[model samples]
Target: MNYINKITLLFLLSISVSFAQEKLSKEDAINLALENNYGIKIADSNLKIAKNNKSILNSGYLPTLTGNAGATYNKDNTEAIFANNEVSILKGAKSNRFNASLNLNYTLFDGLGRLYNYKQLKEQYNLTELQARETIEKTLLQLFTVYYKVALLTENVALLTQSLKISKDRLTRVNYQFEYGQNTKLFILNAEVDVNNDSIALLNTNQLLLNAKRDLYVVLGKKENPNFYVDTQVNFLTKLNKQELFGQVKTNNVSLLQIQRGIEISSFQLKANKSGYLPTIGLTTTYGWSKSNNNSASFLLESTNTGLSTGFNFKWDLFNSGRTRTQIQNAKINYDIQQLSKQQKELEITRDFNNAWEEYKTKLFIFQTQEKNVETNKRNFSRTEEQFKLGQITSIEFRQAQVNLLNAQSNLNSAKYDAKNTELKLLQLTGDLLNTEF
Candidate 1:
């Protein structure tokens, strides 16, 4: 095996019970999450509602249509009053009335309030659609982060298994050496402790990896799931600059987009509130038909009345206890606050990007230094082992060299995965990670 391969195989044999590779790429995970995640579903449902409600504002422009029918019977000992100065007193009277009408009322104009509302709702629907897109991006980002983490942890567990195997072999060697008076009891004890430490570390990493995998599956909304394995051989170097990355992040970060939508919605609402000051003009028309039969004195009379009337209506809130004005002011304040929130979110994104970038760079340097350290430690241990085998060095000195080699290998593996993770975090923060393909 090549040096890296040898070290990897050894570490994995020492740390894991089994090592298997099953790969799911970043794109696949993100697409699945966006399609199935709960947050995305909620956003989609709300978008549907928004679309259904948007046209309600236009209903005011449509004519109001109504129909009615009724019949009544009455009797009285009465006197009736008439418009023509004619009145009658009767011993008994009975009346039957029947009426029916179909009416239509179209608002010829409504102070343009209805028009404003229709425009506003259409814009509101667009805003809701933008919100849904925001949710999708967020879910995708989260999915990528979890998926990559699981991948890194799985690699760690495999490497640690290899380490455990080497420890076991070393333990056997130590016992043989002691029986021949070539090693001490303390040497055997150190070997056993290293093996135990490797076992414990393996357990912890395995559990963490399992949790990450399960979390990803749950986010994908899968009720039944397959064991996840991720590709760890990804190249960390890429062509991404802060400016381009930041631009993409600002566009794709859904929370920030949602806040921007809130600002727009609130602005329109403020405009709607101020509409109360505008004169509202309306056209109204009424049509009626009625028929009645009267029984008074000795004779019965039937009468029918039908009329259609149309008129203009105007409502100007010339003055009210400042209700509309206060509402407008409050809406403006809300709009301003939303804008401020959006600005704050932008600053936070910048900070997050910077932190992740620094971490990745720091880990990358550590990984490089540790890589050389492992190779040098292996060479030194080999020379020291030769010296001890020739009886020029004590058993303890030889064992310490072996221990240093093992520790160096462990450190190198850890730094490799840590650097990868930090790079992943940087990509995630900048919203570029979701687009990352294996």
Candidate 2:
């Protein structure tokens, strides 16, 4: 048993090692998220249902045909008395009966109700398709957001690790100086505290990175694998102007398209309701046959019948307590609501686009500022280190410079990711999120 246990443990370890070695790139992550996302799967299922509903066969465009067959058997005894005092008796009288029929029905006209209903179904089918695209775009946006978050946290871990290294190096210098009677014991103590603090920071940052990777993996429909890691590099966005963005958003946004479809669907509904005020015409045809026999006596009695029928049916609902009118009115109201909703959405689009645009600009500025800050802090930290070594500055001043550099790097990472998020939002608004190469 112990041997088997050992083998199982070894196998699990190997699997973990393999996962650890697999480096997930951004494109791979995006692809996996798209393919495995539960939301996308549901949307695909709904799309299939819509396509099935859109079929002409479901729209009442074709005639209906039917066939039926039946049979029965009976046995009975009977006695009959005549008016002239003559009597007749029969026993064990058996009879068999069978019948079959075929029928067909076709609607010749229904005030064009069928046509309008078919149009509505087609519009609904298109609406469902748009809904699926909306789901895909939203899911992709969420994925990209999480992916960038993981990248930011990864960068944070690296930053803290480097800071820890710097702290340890300073601690070693402080200890050496103290042994040479050139530095105070307090300096050594503070140096050790700095190293400890940096270590703690690195540990916390590493935990955050792990949590983020778990989130990404869950979004990709995978169990949390501690060894799973994504690329850490930050991506910058190209310049975009508000005018071009607004123009694209108005024409291509999925939400707007859905609203337009809503209007179309409402119009079709109104047309269908109005159809009730017009006369309807239909054609029906049927053919039938029946057979019966009695064999209780030597003499045989049998009956067979067959017939064909064809006819047209016409109906007009002159009034229905104004129910049809009410439905039409309701449909009109819904159409108006959809129009208003579309206007509201257009406004929302404008607001969202402007918000994202301004935020992109703000993040861009902050990123640029942090870039310059990092350069300055780098030079300042270098000078501080030289001065500290020459006994021209206190260890506290040197540590302050190191902290400044770390702060600059952290801020830069935040700005970088912030800008990426805005860019993603812009892509979603402009309907470009799905078309972009990950």
TM-score winner among the candidates?
2
TM-score of 1: 0.75
Model 2: colliding residue pairs: none
Question: What digit string (tens of lDDT, one per residue) describes model 2 on residues 1-438?
Answer: 653234335435644664646678988887887789899889999999999998988999899999999999988786757677866677877789999999999999999989999999999999999999999898888887888888898788778868877887888889899999998899998987787677667666766777887888877877656465677676565667788878889999999999999999999999998998999899999999999897544244898999999999998888889998999899899989999999999999989888888888888888889899999999999999899889899999999999999999999898888877888888889887787766
Q: Model 1, which residues run further than 4 Å from truth? A: 1-24, 56-63, 73-96, 178-181, 184-189, 246-256, 285-309, 342-350, 367-438
In candidate 2, where is summed lDDT lowest over 10 consecutive residues? Answer: 2-11
Query: What overall lDDT goes with each candidate model?
Result: 0.74, 0.84
At residue 330, give the lDDT of candidate 2. Answer: 93
* Candidate 1 per-residue lDDT over residues 323-386, each given as its tens digit: 9899989998998898899999999988887887778778989999998998999899889867
Q: Which has the greatest lDDT?
A: 2
Poorest 10 consecutive residues by lDDT, candidate 1: 13-22
Per-candidate TM-scores read 0.75, 0.92
* lDDT (Cα) of model 1: 0.74
lDDT of 2 at 55: 98
Candidate 2 vs. true structure, TM-score:
0.92
